[model samples]
Target: VQILDETGKILVDSGVQKQYVDVTNTQGSWVVTTPLVANQKVQVRVKVSDGSLWSEWSEPGWMKYELPEKRASLVVGEKNSTYVKADGTLWMWGDNEFGQAGLGTTGGKSSMAMKIANLENVIGVAVGSNHTLALTQDGRVWSWGYGYYGQLGDKNRTYSTYPTPEKVPNLDSVVAVTAVGDYSMALKKDGTVWRWGGSSSGVEPQKLNFTGISAMAQGNPRNAGIVLKSDGIVLDFQGKQVPGLDGVVAISQGDGFSVALRKDGTVWTWGGNSYGQLGDGTTTNREKPGMVKGLDEVEAISVGEYHVIAMKKDGSVWVWGNNRDGQLGDGTKTNKLSPVQLAGIDAARIATGKSHSMVLKKDGTAWSWGKNESAQLGNGTTVNQLNPMEVQFSSK
Candidate 1:
């Protein structure tokens, strides 16, 4: 394998470099070191041989380099994973049984990362229980996979799954999208909220007349979607406002509860507590938002099926709720009713699945633990891990 510049000048040759192979076969990655110049156009070609047979050099795969920066993001679903690169290309992996990976096929599953074909200029992405949505730089929205509840926003509530990304009809100039638990929600650039799929009101996106809305959190099945107005007031999907909360900056809705982060560095939660997801030191469900004990200066929050994780401003991570699958990452399977700090690491962002937890470290590396039933851990195996493990991708 060799990397060549636009003039066909070989810059890095791998033929004489140290090669790495997996003896366990479960490992599926190789490390290739090369120095890349900004705004450089490069291509790579590879050939193979096996004692008795030799293969010709493969066609060159071209790529353009951008200024190196850690601006990428990741989202983990119930059985799939989506990653958006700094260059605006989206990539997916994990279970594709329902075509949720958006790889243009509902064919079984793939442990290898597959770039979502034809998806470009993607500025943001969100994944639902079995569907996916992407927001482009031009404000166009695209959707695919399980549309049983009309979450695709195509105006039809048919029980179908799209293998490829299809533009959501009747929506444009959208700034954000949220796909979760059979339902979908979008916020237009006009400060208006639009909803579709699985909401009690039915399938088509109905415009909520409330302006000054800035952020939203979609409930995960049977829970009400909540949004934050510019004044920091919280309102439910039915347009009814929830009192006792103000100055909210961000929000997250879980399986049966909703969480709000305030400007004062406090975390508040409401709704079902069957799994102690509220993290208030009890199993009592609160109809109104209540402060989560022992957490402050929270920078971001991520919620899974019945668990929640908070990243503090100091770069520490804290978790609570369901630990049946070790999603809590406390090195124990015991569920906690109050938040517990996950020691020994600092993170820039956090993403959660139904039963797994992942964090992108400040150093640009990804780590995950818990449910690996569908290889969601991205560690090239189908084994559940109770501790954080680095995810390695195969090199071409």
Candidate 2:
């Protein structure tokens, strides 16, 4: 591999450079070095042996010389990054290749934090492929990520470089909000649910006309959901009761399915089951919620892109579904048709990134596993894994 200047000039030549591989196989450094020899303008070019002849020098990684500048927030496209500090301050990193970081136009990945101004009461933060959402205790939602799909919900197509709260014509009454990947969902005080986004999210779940709705799980496009009433009844958007289940206390988003945890500790699931992600011990797809059969005492649950996880009241973690990307944390790449106990993880809180999961312990510690292609695992670099590892949070 050789680092070259824009005019095809050599910057750094790894003499012979014959031992290198392509970008996909490289977890991180094989293409460009970190600290990047400081303030240098260069990109990556490679040569490889592919079964026969050495492949021609491949196209460059296209990276260029960039001077370091600080920012408060940034948003590019699919790649988004943000963080909440110990002092309640906010920071961002990633593709901001488009200024979606909310820190003005300082796009591109930043190793430092960009301060989102004038915003207070920061409680939680979420990112989409190119947009950002910040949650405040006052029940207000701020967005600055992608706006191209009307996803910003600000009803404007112009991109923003700072956190701005948008009121969905009828959503000023929203009580809580959630954004997954590039879609958004809101829960209302009237036991209703609301949402907006791309077709990928499917058709939006209808607005319910109920009084006791207590919880909601992701729904079709924009934001739809399976509403769990206070009386242990599940209903669709028009107030019609959903058949075949009850006792749901929590609901989570999964690849092509939804997992609901009943108050009694038993688990129920429905929707796309191509990978048997529902944990019913079979690969059959069920349009309505079905019981998980034997999982009891489940205290918490989370859904990965193609996998599901549950935490038992006894500190045990259960994993299921697509294991090809190791999102199951099952110590192997083989997918599971039903829930399997994830050995050795003593956890309290659980969170699922697109293809990875994080386990937060009672000791202020965290463990990560699955895809690390973007360093979402926080193990210090981009490397996918089949098992969990301690995440060293960078405070610097």
Candidate 3:
């Protein structure tokens, strides 16, 4: 067997190894010790032993990783942070507290470049505030990390000490899942949903069945995604009724009020209305969903602990509600009652952590702005970011 670089340079030639003297009857590998640059060039040839004659070299197989590229799908947890490239292998880096890094017991947070322990064939990822969830090709869910809130669904409260992938019970046919703050909600292929985690309301609603859920929105750990029902209202995953208005395509809830986007592109807000967080064209609060009269055509929205960011179909960004600590990303500490566009850059995708907001551009690069105290902005330092800044992903 032999390994070659893309330029036809031989990297490994097992045919010449002295240890392979009787290799004519067994499968063997030639390890190249040289430092090879990423995407440098590579192919492998396998020789099978057949009696006195050697088999022909096998077809060339290129060596390339599968994560963090143009369509980079990522799995970010407290530790063992990972992302998948277009080809599909996963790469991760971060604090490995509690064996979430999945490299093994030895694969603690400080470990380097090791493949995630015993994990592969992953296609989707969801991260809670402390744990992580991975969805596989078979529609099964795998979880690792802290399970204090029964987030890992072990049915017992024990911190997972290593990167052990466990199938989530009662979720064999899930189609989509979201894990934020602490709890998790997964939508099934049949449009029904299931949830687990102590964060939910002490009492859950019953009979939550629907034909299809077009969009879902999640709140903090205790609050869950208000699944938009076919009857034009929102319900908890369990079919119990929940608070909020109709025709909501997206909902972003913060500490004070919850914001919802309707099918007509208008915004509706309810819940905590203190500090004018509802943005209903007035400072008064409403227990039921009410339209934000002047603003319309919102495509997507994200809620921070106290603020909100919305995206229009034309690649424009809007911010309003809470601005203390500058979570609004509008370059000011002033609370806004109407949508305000972020200057300088165009946004295509919107994602928000506790207080920070991240946007993915159409060109494949990612930029994050807003509160950066915890280095959530990924710009190298812990300083706050009031505007968008590019993230320098490791080349590996």
Candidate 4:
């Protein structure tokens, strides 16, 4: 076994360290200890020798190592938090009144992060008001929590709670998913969209006519959905267009509005603005998408019931809109119609809930602020954190 940097420099040579000394069992796998000497892309190849015969070197597997700042995906529900680590482990915490936490029981609340029992290989996750949706690396979708209204997509008409993951029936090869309100949406690999649960329609998985869809976001009501197409067009699930938006790289939907990040590092927002979730420096609602005032180099965005959060390309975080519960993480509860930057931390990604905010730092740490009546902060207490509080995950 050998590990080499992108430039072909040897980083680790198992032959020199005799790491593969167990040569008696050819059927067993070999293990080696290697230290990464630099933060960069590396490739590894393995060779097996059985006494007299030496096997050819295996195909190289390339991987990137950005230690301490590895990537992570996070989602904050109305009263819970969910995160997926770089290693594909899924975790959840906070309110579980309806088994939304998916721990197999309807526990009141969990102040510490709990690993979803037996859930692995997760590539993405979305937490709705009272349910969750997870996408595995193999393109399967699993859901749990509130199954009422058929949001779980298992085809059971009865309304109830599930505390464990259930495979979404008749759905496969799903690339992305979002659980919002009493409904859920999935984007297939074929660029088509599917909808299920209670919305303007009934509880069932119905295929949308739109194709070339890349991503999806849920707007205020369960019926409202924003779709991002592969051709850079942004449209609503009802087939209405998001005016003034193009070259969009990402999209996020809130209570009644939606936000989109353009390829040129700017943000465009529209829909309801009663609490200024639009971030356009006004409380006026917009019928068409427009640029969010004074923000650029934006990388990602998340919207809550009436608030919004954005992560800039520089890793800095900014917030706007409703702050009655201090979800803004800006050390105050005053509402802002414009964006306000949070100091002292740079985040890799962010997620917004009904009245709380969650961020995954570049260094792989989780933090939260705002409504903590149910201890969503995962910091061992129910006290609300006006600013960021590091969330402690239970040891696996």
Candidate 5:
């Protein structure tokens, strides 16, 4: 097999200058380790031999380079779900009562994902109770939906709802955005924090005094903000360091609790554990961070109103906490005090809504389970799913 640049020059693997590399019949694919320039166009052609005469080169297949930020992503709100395809087109469905689906109407609910014609080049999306925020490749933010609490960040405090996307004023260079409850928060490229919405900040975004923040997560219902610093320390919304928590690489917040993933692959939890969402084997609220029971080598995590979903390095998913609606995807309504492995799928990404859960599988397909009263599962039905079911989109 050989890889050629746009000009037809053969690309050699690193540490060797050979124009092509031979592969065994057993090898189904190969990786081109040579560094590629941004936006570089390339093509590949393959040939096979049966230990005799060599076959002619196959047709060249074109490949287009895309930045890492251009990859697809999924996010869920209280009762709605949104997805941005790799091509930068956005799609959404479920509860549109408040127009959170960004479909320009609030009367009908969509069970299958519908494309949002107004949004393009969306790199990331964040959803709150009834509001949605989209971050574009240019580092600008767009908002819509319930605006009574000013969560829209569009500087229209009097407007109760925005059925269409509106550019959030005064925010630029935003690397990330998170929303929950009645407000929203943004992290800038400069490591600064900006907040708007709710009664605290009004309609315009206010720059918080906090700095050096590497990432941020906000708790649902509680609206508590947690930020991770480059120095590996975690701080709460008050800018106070979380007790006994350090070396944290990622953070997520739920109803009244917080979760942190350490660099060592262990999970930690603190705060309200009324339903054992903390995975500590006891419904005890932790004022300080403590290691979650029976979990390790965790690669990623997502927290819902009263549940937690974790993915291991091997792609296995585990969940614990309030499972009254089967959000845990364990095929039962039983709430687990400790992490329980979710069988049947290998997850590439996971998201949790108020009472539902979603998983983007390694094969690029999406699945969902749990409460579907509002059709948030995107399965074309309103039946509650106790196990994972493939989400059906209206169109590709």
Candidate 6:
């Protein structure tokens, strides 16, 4: 057996062995030890020998060597944290009073991150106040946790809580899922949005009339929904376009405000500014989107209950708004009316709970801070961290 490059250059050669096979031995496999570049095109050729004479080499079989996706993702809820490792395995920790941990038990809390035993191939996850939703690679959505408000979207509203994963029926081709408060939203591959739970939508998933949505964001305390259309326009759930907000590449909603990241790397925010979560250097809320003060070259942004986190193109993280619980990760509990750089850390992705913050570094390590009374930080303690602390995960 030989593995060759596109140009027929041998990359791996498995020498002939003395092993013999009978007619019944139809199933066979080989473990190739050669290290190939990711996404590199290659070919394979195999031949059989009968101890004396060798058969002709078989026709080349074309293949591509793609390394497993190694990007880690983090999502934080009101008092729980969900993590998806590079291997597509899901983990949960912290508050479980309403069974948000999805460990098949309620009224219990886990200080250390535990791997979800029955869920796998999870590409994305979203959490509400007490419920959780997971999106698999095959476009299926699985949910658990509080269902009294129909947040589970399983069409069974009689059950108040689900401690384990249950399929959200009639939901397929879902490319993304997000939940906040008691409502959930899903973005389909066809650019349509489906919502369930909350006061407006009931237990069953209801397809919104709008289409061409590329991404979405939902607020925690306000129950507001914002969507980013493929044409770069940002619109509210009521089909109203946000004034002066266009060319948006991403959008996020917090307690009572919403944020948009433009293609020029500038951030615009509006809505509740009680804690200056809008980052406009003023406590007054605006009816129209305004440019966040002193934020530029921003690559990504996330919103918490009353705080905002923005990662710049240089890998630096900045925070502002409600810091009463030190959710800003600035080593202080003072709220900043303007964006302040979070020192000593480079972030690859960021997420925020109601009163806590999380960062996933490029090196695959995760850190958390702020409110930890429910052990949401996953640092083996329930004490709030004014500074970032490394999260502890179980080996098993």
lDDT of 2 at 316: 90
Candidates ranked, most accurate by TM-score first: 6, 5, 4, 1, 2, 3
Q: Tell me the lDDT of model 3 at 117.
A: 49
For residues 1-396, what per-residue lDDT tens digits would candidate 1 score against the true structure?
Answer: 778999899987877332335332332223343546768899988765543465798899998867535377778777776667778888776777777888788857666456888987787888887789998776788998877778888855357678889888878878888877787778998899887887434567778767888988865766667888988889987888888999999988888788899999899999989888999999988898899978999988888888999999998999999899888887889998999898877898788888898888888777888888777777778778788887766453
What is the C-alpha lDDT profile of model 6 across 125-152, one tens digit per residue? Answer: 9988888999987688999888888888
Candidate 3 or 5, higher TM-score? 5
Model 4 CA deviation exceeding 4 Å by range? 1-70, 199-203
Q: Enumerate residue pairs that collide in model 6.
A: none
Q: Write the per-residue lDDT of candidate 3 for residues 84-199, one digit (tens) a residue.
A: 54444554444445545444442333322334545655667766666667766556777776665666665643433435667776566666666666566666676766666554
How should the candidates be ordered by lDDT, best one leading?
Answer: 6, 5, 4, 1, 2, 3
With candidate 4 superimposed using the best TM-score fit, by how many Å does residue 176's alpha carbon deviate from the native?
0.5
- lDDT (0 to 1) per candidate: 0.81, 0.63, 0.61, 0.84, 0.84, 0.88
Q: What is the lDDT of residue 263 in candidate 6?
A: 100
Pairing residues by index, what is the TM-score of model 3? 0.66
The parts of candidate 2 lying over 4 Å away from their true place are: 1-120, 124-127, 156-173, 199-211, 219-224
Please give each candidate's TM-score: 0.78, 0.67, 0.66, 0.81, 0.82, 0.82
Candidate 5 lDDT tens digits, 108-143: 688988898778778889888888899987788998
Candidate 3 has its poorest 10 consecutive residues by lDDT at: 199-208
Model 2, 162-253: lDDT tens digits are 33434344344455566665566666666666666554333233354556667665533333456678888877655577777776788776
lDDT of 6 at 382: 97
RMSD of 6: 9.2
State the TM-score for model 6: 0.82
